[model samples]
Target: MELRDYLRILHRNWILILALTVLGGAGAYGYSLLQTPTYEASTQLYVSVRSESSGVSELAQGTNFARQAVVSFVDVVDSALVLDRVIDDLNLNESAQQLAKTIDASSPTNSVIISIKASNPNAEMAASIANSVGTNFANVVVNQLEKPDGNAASLVKVETIEPALVPTSPAAPHTAVNIVLGIILGLGLGLGFAVLRSILDTRIHSLHDIEAATDSPVLGGIALDPDAKKRPLIVHADPRNPRAESFRSLRTNLQFIDVDGASRSFVVSSAGPGEGKSTTTANLAIALAETGARVALVDGDLRLPRVADYMGIEGGVGLTDVLIGRAELVDVLQPWGTGRLFVLPSGRTPPNPSELLGSQAMQRTLEALAEAFDYVLVDAPPLLLVTDAAVVSRFTSGVLMVAASGTTKKPQLTAAVEKLNAIGSRLFGVIVTMLPAKGPDSYGYGAYSYSVQEESVSPSGRGERRARRSKTEET
Candidate 1:
């Protein structure tokens, strides 16, 4: 992934990352608190051969002897042999092997200096162990080199520069270092998880996501109408609203999307219920009708009809009534006052809705509607719930899928698309609805400028238009 992708993931999952980091730090701190305190003590010893009134040969020999013996002495201090004597003299609780674990010995490079260090639970015990090991090693070396002469035979002498002191603080457990390491590890792990999850998520949320998924051009995004509840007839009550503008844009795009195919009917539906399919169809039909072309709005979902409610008309007779020969076309046809927009409600809920919507009568009705109207906007049932949408989509010009933002699952959407594709329905595009507005980066005030202008003019313009009509009638 690119840097921005990783950044977005971090932004989206900051809480998870923070929790893990804090948990790691807390765990390290708890471990540090439970640990026993240990103190370290170290002593520096100078190892050199003692010489008489020196000759050049004697001085060179003494330096060579010191170099060779220093390594041996370091080994001896680290071994069980030297530690056994020291432990016995100090009356230590640990055995020779156990004491070796607490002791460390090292010799400086090109120098006759040796450092001995030891750690113990008590500071005084640590100091005593360091001092005893250095003093005992020196005594053993002197005795081994001694000979029966008036002057002692050539031997090495160990001189103490700094005596071991009881250390106040332990060195094994560094609280800050441990905590920092834990945080780094935890952060790394959390980021890996976030990246993996992002890679696996295939749900379409934005136009960018759809483009990336299907390599299709996103002509425009239709925002969920904020006043959809109060004003259902967006194109009529608020013709200049942004949502109305969006439907008009969709209508225009539809003109180009099917350039080669027959100019025909279109199916508007969703993967699930409450995705604004009926409202979109109603508004789109009105907008299309405003272009001075005949537009027919058909409610294909006979199970749960909403077109009549949106058009503020009766739904007792519509497509079902016409299909069963109970009513004629003119009896159910209701013109929506101004434009060429016409309403075809769902009529009555039928027990055999699936069979009726998929029958030859439904096809004949669509053919008749297509011949008379420039656009046939059919509102069908959700594809996931029933096969009515898929069946109707097969005979229509194309299908426009409506998806609710932040609520639609990727799997459910993919399944719906697959079902439509299996039946050979031409999938046009997806509409994302119910997206949140008030955010730092969202559809800005610029998008709603037309709506604001229309709202301001509607109040005054309505009164003027009414007065003009009244004056014309009186004259």
Candidate 2:
């Protein structure tokens, strides 16, 4: 995917990311509060070798020997030998081996100085341990390691350079650092989860998914309405509503479908059931009739017809009666809403809907309706569930695939397109229904003024009023 795709994923899951980050920081702070606070103290020791006869050469050799010995003495500072003396002097409860775990020793390069650090729960105890360890280490190196004979004085000396002081604050359980690290860890995990979900999820969320899956242009997006089932005929019920306006916009886009103006009939179908194909067809027909166009809305689904129910018309005898010679086409077609729009309901549930719809009699009926009406819209069944839509498409100009946003999967949409392609049916365009009104994947409709003017004035009257206003300004 591109960078914008990743950015969109991040925008969509921003709440989850923020919640995880805050949780991580809070957890780190709580953990820090429960941990024991440790205080650290450090002391430095200076090592020097005694010179003979105050000669420059002897002094240089002694200094070099001391620098080399100090490096090794740093390691011995944290050993059991030095820690044992430190424990004895300070009356520590732990053994030398255990006490050594809290001690650290190091020396700078080419330097005769050794640094020792010790940590404990008590600040005073930590300082005492550091000081005691330095003192005992110096004594051991002078009397035992560097002493030449039993009666002679030691030739090397170790002096305390910087004594350890009691620390005012804890050295471990860094609250601020821990919280920052926790937040960073949480942010990484959140982004990983968001990206993975975006990659794995196949649901159609926006026009981008439709464009990616097929080459057909999206006619328009219908805003989701919770009470859509109650008022299926939105264009007639609420003409000024935004969702109703969307159908009008879809009606405007539909006009440009057949540039040559050869065929006006279209089959509306979806991948599976409950994708708003019937409602879209019914509302679109009403929207077209608003322009004073003669529209014929046919309930083509013989299996389970819904246009009749949604249009509030009688469905006892309609398309099936005409196809079986029981009724004429002009007799079953019912006018709706005192407009030029007509509704042809599915007469009865037939066992062989495919065979009946694909018959030449159904073709002749659609051809006669197309000749009479300005626009003929047939609401067919789902393409995947049956071949009725594909068969109907052969008689119409093209098929309009209506897919539900966030409900129809990409694979399902592709398979539906494939079914149309297999029968060489023209996929005119796509219409996405149930689109959200907000967020990154929302379908945005431009604001339109619906308020009617309270008064009317002609152009000559307005010009005379402007002339009078100019004369008054001159006075």
Candidate 3:
């Protein structure tokens, strides 16, 4: 993924990331509160080599010997020999090995000073332990290690420089530092989880995702409205809504899909059901009619037709009736709004919808409707659900695939495209529906001008046009 993609994921899941970060900080702070307060105290000891010689060369050799001995002396501070003596003197319940864990020793290179530090729950005890450990370690180095033969006076002597003082603050529970580390750790985990979720998510939520799944240019995206179910026919029910504007945008984009004029006759389909194929078809027809163009909206989905219900027109006798010669096109074609747009509702639910849609009579019906109307939009069944759409697509200009954002899966879309390819159906651009109004893939206002002249077809004029159309069909 590119930087933008990572940034998008972070932006999309910022709430989760922030919540986890705070939770981590809270957890660390609570853990620190439960921990015992440990205070640290340190004491310094200066090691020196005593000699009878007063010459400068002899004094330099004594100082060099003290420096070399300090290295070994620092290690002995944490040993059992030194810690056991300190534990006995302080009456500490801990053993020499356990007491050593609380003590640390270090000496600066080329220096004769050895520093011993001890930590404990009690501030006074910590200081006493440090002072006692330093004194015991010094005595052991001078009286024991220096006089290994126990025959003569020892040359090494150690003295105290800085005595340990009682500490007022804790050393282990660094609250501020722990919180910072907790935040850092939380952010890492949150980011890792976000990337994993994005990778595992197979839903098609953006135009780029749809394009990646199929070689189809996205014509337009419809903003998702929570109240869409209450107002499915948005173009007519709520014309000023942003969603209605999107339908108009889709209409405009569909007209200019290619360099030349876009194809007028195409079946709107989806990979699966409930992807807004019917709703898109209804709105697009209304948008086209708003431009003073004669549009024929056909309910091509015979088994489960929605165009008649969405248009509020009679569906007792329409497309199926015309195809079976039971009714003429003009008799059943209903006009909607104050325009030339006509609705060819699916007359009745036929058992063999797929067979009827692919029949020669259905092709002739579509061809005649194509000649009669400037645009013919067929609301067909889902490609994955049934073969009706795939069969009907062969007779139309192309198939306009609709994919619901965050709902449609990539595999379903790919399979739909493959189905179209196998049937040699022209995969006319995609239409992304239910896109969020906010987020990375957001809907925006259009800047380009469209030729939407306000030319309303009067009721009387529509009647005359219907009469003329009927006479022509008869002739």
Candidate 4:
């Protein structure tokens, strides 16, 4: 819709654009190789119509007659009779009708000069065709139009001004011109395709899309955790990993998003499942704990919980037991290693999750947790599937909606945001998941803090250090 939008489309579909350009250029080049070159030659004929007689009346009549004769001869230049003679004189293999196509006769404006042009594969043949057509027409005009009724009439004549020369080069099959035309055509097609695809695609592929859809600022774009399954304790084992760093960056963004207000408790949820909502909650809690803040990771989705599995703890006798008055919160709560992080897993799947979250006791439990911890990160079900997240958000401080970059549609994201706003949930911001590596030029700042770090080292050593840094930086 704007310049930046077009640029984003081009960036996203560069492969398609490159493929189309190469295909069009290759097709044009191959066609140029197959085309036969055609050469052209032209010869001029001048009409001589003099008005010279003894008396004034005779001179006027002679002038009129000469003009009429010249017009008549001009028509006869390409007649079947002229072509038949020209074809035979040139020893052409084609018939008179076919040879007529290669020959053309034209009279210049307000002048008695007629030009004969011919085209052929061979330069010499083209020159010969031009001369032969002119010669045959000259002979026909002198023999038939000048002499009338088998008696000598007042003469009108035409003569060749310049002899037709053999052309040195072809006039067609321009390889350079065709290649340039192909490039223009290819670029137009590629841009058209990019625009069409951008219009058709309704998925959110960038941080801009999330901001536009929800009217919320983008906190950070987190890369997909590549070794997400390799180890469950990503925050503790690989705290400096890029994936972990993203969570810490997100934590920092949250601190400054609206520092004037105090909103510590957050509900982490998405439009649908498998958008990394649970992992994001666990990581955020760990990141916050690393800052020496007491953080509680709550498995609020009693319907289906994953925080316990990710934290490598037993799921029995946790959140459900604490909610149903069967167990104490302190007894079921597990400490996450030696960090100031605590987890409350969903003891078992419950059929009355919405009722439990909406009850007054749930509100009291949230108040108690808020007093005990510095931050409470509740991992809840997807917004579209259930009202658990929305119901829980009424008691929490704010809501942080998670959305997959390419998987979440605009309409779905909008609906999810509207649902939260409809229930009076304070939306903090959106976190964009699964973005490709942001190149320095791509960001338009001409400087990434990471790329600038390489400038401190020598060029020869930069390559090896850059690789090692990338491996260390990437998770």
TM-score of each: 0.75, 0.91, 0.89, 0.83
Local lDDT at 272 for model 1: 87
Candidate 4 weakest ten by summed lDDT: 440-449
* Cα lDDT of model 3 by residue, 1-475, tens digit: 7898888788778888888888888888988999999999999999999879989999999999999988888889999998889888989898998998898888887999988899999999999999999888888987888875757878998999999999988898999999988888888888888889889998987766886799888888888889988888988897766678778888888887652234369899999999999999999999999999999999999988888888888898988888888888889888889868899999988788888899999999888888788899999999998999999998888899999999999999999999999989998788999888788766564322223344558866762222111111100
Write down the lDDT of every candidate, Cα atoms only. 0.77, 0.90, 0.86, 0.79
Please report the candidate that would top lDDT against the real structure.
2
**Model 3 spans > 4 angstroms off:** 148-151, 258-263, 446-475
lDDT (10s digit) by residue, model 4, range 1-475: 7887777788878888888888778878888889999999999988765555578787667656655566666678878888889878877788888887777777755557788889999999999988998988888887765655766653667689987999998987888888778877887899899889988888887766776698888777677556777765566777655666777788888777553234378889999887878888888888888888888899999888898988889998788777888888889889986658999888988789999888887787777888888888899999999999999999898889988867888999899999998988888888877655463111111111233234355666654334223333321
How does candidate 4 fare on TM-score? Answer: 0.83
- Greater lDDT among 2 and 4 belongs to 2
Higher-lDDT candidate among 2 and 3? 2
- Best by TM-score, which number? 2
Overall local distance difference test of candidate 3:
0.86
- In angstroms, the error of model 3 at 128 is 0.5
Higher-TM-score candidate of 1 and 2: 2
Candidate 1 Cα lDDT to native? 0.77
Descending-TM-score candidate ranking: 2, 3, 4, 1
The sequence of per-residue lDDT tens digits that candidate 1 reaches over residues 260-366 is: 34456889888889888888888878878888889889999988888899889898889999888898876798899675888888898989998888888888888
The TM-score between candidate 3 and the true structure equals 0.89
Q: Which segments of model 2 are wrong by more than 4 Å?
A: 259-261, 449-475
Error of 1 at 367 (Å): 2.7
Off by over 4 Å in 4: 53-76, 91-93, 145-147, 229-233, 257-263, 439-475
Error of 1 at 351 (Å): 4.7
